[model samples]
Target: MTFPRTLADLSTAELGSGYQAGDFSPGEVLDAVAERIAACEPTINALWHEDLAAARSRAEESGARWRSGQPRGALDGVPVTIKENIARKGVAMPSGHAAGDPQPADHDAPITERLEEAGAIIVGSTVMPDWGMLSSGVSSRHGITRSPLDPALTTGGSSSGAGAAAAAGYGPIHIGSDIGGSIRLPGTWLGLATLKPSFGRIPLDAPYLGRCAGPLARTVDDLRAAMTVIGRPDARDYSQLPPYSGDYRVPDFSVSGLRVAVHTEAGCGMPTDPEVAAAVDAAAQRFADAGAQVTRIAPFMSEELLVDVDRFWRVRSWVDYHGLDIEDQRRILPYVARWCTAGADVPGAELLRCYQSIQTMRQATVAATEPFDLVLSPVAPVAAFPAEWPMPFNDPDQPMGHISFTVPYNMSEQPAASVNAGYTADGRTVGLQLAGRRFDDAGVLAAAEWFERSAEIAAPERTVG
Candidate 1:
């Protein structure tokens, strides 16, 4: 039994089957990933840390388990990477900031523990924006994470390296956290599959709002496999939902009777690139052709509501910034510095107002989508922008434009995902977002799988040189 192509090219499910069939060993998979990462790292800068020696040892253990017909679990021998923000035992959680103490964590985040227990080989940590604040990949600590499809383009963040690594085939699964669009934004830009599960679907031990841990993968099947292992309740996260009892396997559901609403703008008259709008429109048409009910709808959120959400996020960043020493704060990226300062003096009344606004926005979103099984929109208003900009707009006055399509769902605490819609004529990748009612994560994933099947979205050609 021998693998004809690079093991890095196989999906997580494929790799699992290959291991079971004795076509390849987990050690071979890790070696293939190391080779690909070595070729791609100079151009992409996707990983911040790696432990190939440890990963190889785990792979050897998994091989022994497979040979004895006592494999530990579903993910045995599968290569996996965690975003920089996640706590991996013995690995420093820098969160992409230059100022944090370099001491490593003594315990694993629940998700990390679960993955390891299931026999997934932990490869390394992926890069992210400073403190996971930015939507693009430039971080003061780890530098920029460029897209594998086109080096000049941004791999959206704060799950920047996860996107780039998944695209470059460093591994089949990556764990990423999303506060606003961290997971989906990068997934869209890098033409990967990612899910931002409903708030509390995956427990997180962080001092932030709307943060949920999720998986970014080359295929929806791989994403589901990772979710099954990591999406369990942890006592550390009091906010986590009760232990999920539902099967993580994407159900066989036809889109024939599904009701999907399409919105190109966030209803605030935000600017959306024509190419992105066209791609989303085509995706909706494909659903319609497949017998689903599709309708173009007005944006569910207003510009003022979006501004308030941005304000709250900035204030949150400000709080985190001030917690660090003044000298350490000075090490933050300029844009992050700007964000921190902008919210430093917000009035208490204004803070309450922002929370009220978020509540209103959530209610509005729930009401608007109640009539539909799923909602379709562009993952972002534009395709991957120039890598140098912190965001597509990068304007201090209107920094939320690129995230208009994504942030609303975060505020709503619903399950949402970014699936490869298609590429623009200029070769930029476009993503179609599928958002479902809160706690309807399975429905959302099923819809994404349907789209993948119907659209036949292809895996990206490896860009490593």
Candidate 2:
């Protein structure tokens, strides 16, 4: 049966209901999604690899199940994109780097395994920066991933393609990873909803500090749905926490009586764009209208903490990249090479010092947030910048300034998300960040849903050719 063009726009829940109601077969939905991807890919560059044939086969199987009076699970037949950094068995996980011999993964990442188990069809692997390092989507291997809302603007990174795919309607659900706001940055710039769940909430095979996998979606409900499936424990990941029993559903509770703190600037002394700040203030007011106790607070980060965190990030990358031979290093992206060199010479004692400072920052953040139910801030100091730039800041000396607000929460290992607050006067998107204490992912998602319902954040008109 032929499906409407809008079939790709359905939320995960809506899509499932439509399948059960026989509105259209899963094959029909897959064909519509393939059309959407073909239409947007040339300009957006959101996907790096696609197996439409495999995806179609999966959809056919799901359609047979639905016709037989049974559906596989919540996400059965859903077209979902996994970020390139995540392994999908038999798919090459180049991660946008040219330095290494690109080998097809022999096993799926735990999250990928779970999503498929829930019957989600893997449509393709999305684009990212080399080593998943940059905040902008410019990659040596995959080219730049532009915003679907405006091709001249960046989609943000290293989950760049996931953001573009989510915004471009490739699907309702996209899997993204965040160490220093990779998911949230792209979500903000692309005008999508994303969650960087508390550390260990989603099991990951990453060896880096502060890295975790989560969902980027068009709606809070979709995020919740994806979380419920991917948040399950995986024995393959040694870092997996004891299984979480907390519900992933957004609570239907009122926003009133919740204590919230609004921070307009980073404690590291980064200045926010006035327009971005205004949007965040307006979001805070929405909470106030809902009877939430909202107070304007200074940023939770300090200059010392920011510096040490930056060092830790650089050294971590240095460790990963340093193992490559000189010839391999030469093939790496220039910006990535610069970051690696910056930390390669650091003494072991200094690295130890950075970890100590990180622990101190974590303690201080937990203490500061203990009294508040939620913390609200701008996801970035500025809206989406030029696609060619590595970051919004022009100075190489201050490369991480734009990520100041979001990265602190990563250090604290807390649950944080980027929600579409509004747009800049120039038509660029701005995101308001919501954070909750560690393991309070539900509260963060619940607050985002309240804002989404109250504000009615609209999806952008297709700007891609």
> Which stretch of 10 consecutive residues in model 2 shows the poorest summed lDDT?
1-10
CA-only RMSD, every prediction = 2.4, 2.4
Q: Give a tens-digit lDDT track for model 1, residues 169-231.
A: 888899898988899999888888999998988877762567788999988888888888888
Model 2, 323-441: lDDT tens digits are: 88998888888877786678888899999998999888888788878889999999988888898887677444554777778887777889998889999888888998999988888
Let me know the TM-score candidate 2 reaches against the reference structure: 0.96
TM-score of each: 0.96, 0.96
Error of 1 at 366 (Å): 0.6
Per-residue lDDT, model 2, residue 396, is: 43
Clashes of each: 0, 1
